[model samples]
Target chain A: MAFEQLAKDVPAYRAPGQQLGARMRMFERDKDELRKLGVPIETVELASETKHYRLASRNFYLPRLGFDAREGTARPPSKSAEGNRPPEVTFSVEEYEMILRAAARAQDLGHPSIARDAVAAVQKLSFDLPIIDPESTEWIVPTPAAGDSVILAVLDDALQRHKTVRLTYRSNEHGVVSRRDVSPYGLLMLRGRWFLVALDNRASAVRHFRVSRISRAVVSVRNAQRADFDVPSDFDIRDLSEERRAWELGDGRPISSVVEFDFSDAVAARGAELGERLTSGRASSRRFAVRRPESFVRWLLAFAGAARPISPHAIVSAWRAAAKDAYANYASADRGES
Target chain B: MTKRSADSASDQLNRVLIALAWLSDGQPHRLRDLATRVQVDERRLRSDLLAIASRTDDESLGALVGSRLSLDDRTVQLHLSLFRRPMALSPRESSAIELGLALIQHEWPRAEAAVAQSVRRRVSRLTTSPVTSSSNAPIHAIAEGMTEVARQSLQALRGALKTSRKARLQYQSFSATSASARTVHPFGLVLVRGMWYLVAHCERVRALRIFRLDRMVSVRVLASPSAKRGDEELRATLERGRAIVKGATERLRVRYSRKVAPWIREDFDVLEQEDGSVVVEHPLRDDAWALRHVMAYGPDALVIEPTRIRDEVACRFKAIARPRPRAAKRRSS
Candidate 1:
């Protein structure tokens, strides 16, 4: 087979009155699209002047996903290379639905970051994307908080691929906006804001980067699909964010901020997140290692007096002042005063 | 890369894949139906259909899925081969859903949680935990106090909102320590910083009241939609929420370490001092919250405010710091 013969054998299409060169360009463009979508095109040259072109069936197609009707449950399809071509990969409706349901659950929960990319990733798996109904009552969470959906998609991509992203981040602690190349560790939504816990390569420390503050249009510092560095095996995104609390995020030193909850109004997962054994034997109290005192106080105030400070004497006075302030506000509001 | 091209490529890829997924069901669908499902106009759908038909190399998607236009030209028919094996979710997709499920647990009614749990059971069967398979991203309820009673109240409120019925509840006002019977038209639920608030119209007060769901001990929703509409009130609440401080007059000034100061200043006004300390001036909304805010800073925050507020905070801290008889009994071993 000659190269000329192979080109001549290739299929040709001409839109009404389209020039031969233009039509050939269209064919070339279609070939590129197939390659980008992960289609494998192999060109075999026999001797100097002869060549052959064919689709690599084994290399190019998706393997199927779903349970065999006879099995009554999903079975792992053995992808044994039989003879001619490789196994094709494809997703069954059940597998596709499972992924979509998870994505829909994210959408209902007001987590756009998970919803957008999970759906996209699901398509990558099945090699197909399906539309989902937002109004479906199959599952629903009570409220939806406003959030930026794309940041999570980008960071999820970075994390999955283990890529470093050079992002312009606005630091809330210093009111300074600076750009840094960070290796994203993971994402945490604490205190109603999403923070990408990443290893700040320059500082050599893991830091919480508020997604809202990360400038839009974050750029990957390296070529796509290229890994510049590896996340340490021992590194955990949860470890980076499993700090004392969101209020204690930036504090350099650790201090104890002991507070007591009412016995009946206690946290269900008591002592689970409190790090160590409870210091007080009392059933109602939990102690936190605090760093940012002001943020702690504001957060504790939301408990609406159900919690009282146990060890920090200064906190009680602030609590009282806040109570009095609330009393005055309520009194005035009751009296129809603005 | 320019923003438009980057976005368009991703968007185009997503549309083509999604279309393929839908059409692969081996069913013939009207072009109108397909276009509506994908939320695209006829023109875009045709372009995407062309992309799919033209680029689906049999070496790739071609073997598993195929599509053709009907003679009428308005219907698209698909052909798909059965999958040999059950495809499982990727680790990242599973983890992403897991985080979402965890984050909304505060608002998850028992039924919804059960639904999520069942889905987790199915998905977990297929997923291998990423990395050492130990560490997971957690959604911690920073503001505690999600009790069973509060959960019951939440259930009732959810039913009320779903059915558009008015609810009667024993709700304790923040200023008062005792719970009082109140009838209200429930609007919707809002979870702020891990705390749940029920926005409703209070018939007794003749105003919109945002009741902390946890504050309600007993809740019952009865038949009958209220005369007042809830959507407007919810809209107003969300709109005014950004501008109005929780309280107008209850303001406090605290000097905090430079670190905590700027984060606070992200929301509240702050004054940076020559010594690198920052003073944050914020209104004291809820008493417990203000106290926790200050205490979260540990000793880094100092109250610089009206003498009464300062004295109250300092004295309260003193009371807590003092060792009680119960404490002595507990620790005397």
Candidate 2:
């Protein structure tokens, strides 16, 4: 009865034993409900004090989006809040400023996509806030914006639609670009960069691919021959990414290494328990369990003067060689030749 | 439950927003007819309208959502406020919202998949028209989730900030001897480099400092007010760090091989000298970290600066070569 056709059809077409005007009252009830939702139904005066109603689609939908600041929110200038139009939203002066602060900061430091979302929030909020001069504010985001939006878009679409994609991904570990069919499970943000944790059909394993290092635009092949795979219902991203550091990369068994460090300077910046098996003395030592052998050694090498691997004579000797090489290189550079 | 409540509140908020945007054209309509279009029953729909009315009158939403409601037995007429012209969100905004959801999906329990779905549904409903693009944009950032301990520490610090109390923080710095416990005036949090840091005033050090929340082993928020505490200059303090990490515009002279120079020059403020080697002289805060950074280049780059720091690098090499006095205690690999 909320629509005019149903309301008119209901009176003469009532169930048996229904009283006169009862269904009409119900129709009245339904009509009141629609009005609460903000739908403006046009009511035309009719014969015998009855009325007809219809919802105009022209007034129903919002303006087409693709909103650009330069083009002015797709709103006509005459329709400003200043005119007979309804009043602008009024947030507390302080709250309004804070929203601006958040928007400006987000635009600079936040992920480019998230920054735009913040901008959208601002656009929506502009109805309530004081006008801000965009030029006056400076944004500072250090990390380079991820350039390949197409790949990201494709991955996101694939994840949501449960569609399998033919991916040509350049492996970060090896610079080789390999084409494979993948079911992208999810997208994640780590260290200010996005990673697609997807199941690679070729490897038969879930791997996280850093979006930044991906070389070019993702070409979505509409190949009918490509088999679509379903993401495992029990797939949890936490299981794959946990305990993994940014520099740590590999799919190997764990290696336990014991290292000692003079924490005088390190502890001032980090703290005890910075590593596993925290201990203190003239020199403190911690045992580190690592899977990425190369990254572990490279990490240890950086701490050579401040920290040392006390074990696996192999690592000790490697550190010694690297140290000797560095000194020798420095000495030669001082002498103007290597 | 609280999460559910928060999610529902947001849903209702979106419903109200879209409803307001739709009715703001100064047209009159029967309440039930409009309710059918918005997909809500008459009772709940009426409550939503009351909620809006009371909210504007009680709080600060008044200027934005004025409406007129008239009911005469069988028919009702209503006109909502014209806050501004309603426009749909752009693709970038939606993508950002999705990325934010992705970030929290794995890391924070409060923003789990369920919450993400709820937010997504609400946002989708608010849109005047469906998003045209079929492709989903994967987010560009991935960060490790905080452990249970780190999460608890964050809660405790948040409590401390609310209470305006000092907290005893047992912090583990990377370059220190051992974990040190000190009282700090916990101010606020700064999320940078995929980690949360507490920007606080250290009582012992008598200076402002940033402590990585992940590195915090234990903490106890004190009951007393922080002595001589000033307003937590969160923006100023974070800005100081921001200038270093994000901009990286300050120039430095780094003498390195031509091969690695391009990579360095592209990433940092680098200037090449007439000599074949690069000199990296970025007035860095962490000279010790800087010393080791140069050391990473192995034979490629060298930092010739404050003699003491240079000597420290040389000492690292000597220590590396001066080993083998004790039995090499190797953990099983």
Candidate 3:
């Protein structure tokens, strides 16, 4: 009845004359008890001679204490007695400086997301601490390069809107920038570098672009609807990067194409770079099937004439014709110079 | 001081202070209101706030009075700066720091000094005696197996969660005879009864499933990822699975011996009661495995309803427990 009366304002209410002071005292006692239990009870004297009393919020009530540790103690320390003594040990200036250094180093050198979180956590710790030297630590994270900022922003926008993007990308060998529209799919960090996986519009295939090489990126207005491509549930990212060569294509359909390499050449020493696809059969011969033939041929030709195509007649013929054309072009250039 | 105790106190103090800072940002809080917000008694909360307020060079208790908290009426209003911070835990910032130091002290003595000293300095201002130690001994034991590779994987998982991106995980399942690749849009990692599980949408099954990390061979953050599962779909999947596995039944009834009655009563809801016996309404699928499970208990368990299940159990028992004549006796006699 007391709580109900306190809930709302009543017009021209008359209180019973008997024991009015006693009831008010009882209310004050209840308020005291509530305060001890961490309940925020407020009392407001209205202009119309009415008193408003209620809890500030539902959460103002503290949770009940289940177990008391002091109950089992044979001799609990007196609160006043324990408060008189100084802390057992105090941190020295040097020690305090070390903590600041460690925290700052962690805050600066760690990943941006992690560093920001750590700083907030440490700041909370500092609130309880008596002394801290924030400036003592020289740990500073380098600001991200301009190129990284551009790439990250574009990737972020594309992901948010689920839109394709057009990028001006320069190839590593050609160094020629070409505009390509791609369906922005995912971003990966491999070997401390970032790569963007997107559906390449020109090739009509999924291709990976190193974010560092991308000079410009623009979110395309056009939405290309394609069959929903689901990433396989069990795909592992570390396996893709941890292998001898980074396979950006993910778990693609297994393709078999034969390649022959001369075992007598220096190219044999570079077997580790060839990865798991190449197999050494005879002492003088190495037979291998390229999993990704397009990417593997450029890697194989780095060995010069030592690496030869064994099968896939078209690849062998193409390599042979390229070699002959290169020889004739060089001979003609020499005659012109003479 | 034991490194573990120091670190634990520091962690507790940090969480408490963060909570306080969030509450103190908007308005001044009355003693009682502040205590309620911080979930401590007025006296203890006053001491803690004084301790914190004393450390700061700018703010004082007077500033609190000028803003939202008023002692005259005992009303407190809170500011809204409490929800802006991002929360993360690292090895150094984790509760395991002290345990890691203690364990590493025995094997890697050289590194122990730095770890122990660091913990000591950080927690010097807090109360010296350990608050709770024995309760966390088991937690330390578990942290022993967290290797660098596992830590890296956990970090990557956290990053992927923040970005809301799908992760390509190379998972090896013990149930699977061989390792298979999978792409998963990871939802969250839950620690249930000491085991870690990643609840995510499995691309292959196109359904939400939980994968035990202990059974996970490796985890990777893929470059190409998919969107996270929507909230409605996730909730519906979990509800459906729970209903099938543990939903209440309306018609099924079973009788149990007095010895097994208590166990049955505790396990299932009771439908009816009679002299020295009770009938329970248990929802179960009509399957071979369910019939076999009912028969395993023998005479201790009996089916009271659904004549088909009772006949099935009896037939299954006869097929397994029947006596057989020896071939030798027939030939020699």
lDDT of 3 by residue, B1-333 (tens): 001111223333444444445454554556674444333456655555445434432233324333433233454444433322212222224322322233222122243346555654444222112112211111111112233444445556656776677776666553243447778887765432223456677888776765656455577777666565565544432331121222336444566554445435433555445654456655654443345344433444555557676655545433323324468658878
The candidate that wins on lDDT is 1
iRMSD (Å), candidate 2: 12.3
RMSD of 1: 11.2
Give the local distance difference test score of model 2: 0.54
The residue-by-residue lDDT of candidate 2 on A1-338, one tens digit each, is 13445534443335577665776666655554444223344565667465666655544433332222344443332222234433322233323343355445444432443454555454443433334443221223334553545566566556655577677666533345777776777766566556777777677766667665455434345643232555565665544545466434333456666777765566322422556774654347777666555445556667646677776676666667767877776667567884
TM-scores, one per candidate = 0.57, 0.54, 0.33
- Which candidate has the top score in DockQ? 2
Candidate 1 local accuracy as lDDT? 0.54
| lDDT for position B3 in model 2 | 9
lDDT of 2 at B195: 66
Better of 1 and 3 by TM-score: 1
Fnat of candidates, each listed = 0.09, 0.28, 0.01
> What tens digits encode model 2's per-residue C-alpha lDDT throughout B112-137?
34544555454443333322122223
State chain A's TM-score for model 1.
0.52
Candidate 1 lDDT, A78-174, residue by residue in tens: 2221222332333344444544554554444334544543554444443323333332211232223333456666776677556788878777545
Q: Write the per-residue lDDT of candidate 1 for residues B1-333, one digit (tens) a residue.
A: 001112345456555555655565656778886665545566777776666556554344432343343313688766544332222343444565555544444345555566556555655554433322212333211222366677778877777876778999898755444679999987677654445677777899787777877668789888978545545445555421232223248677787765455456545556888877788777666554465466544445666665455555555544443435787888986
Q: Where does the lowest 10-residue lDDT sum fall in candidate 1 chain B?
A: B1-10
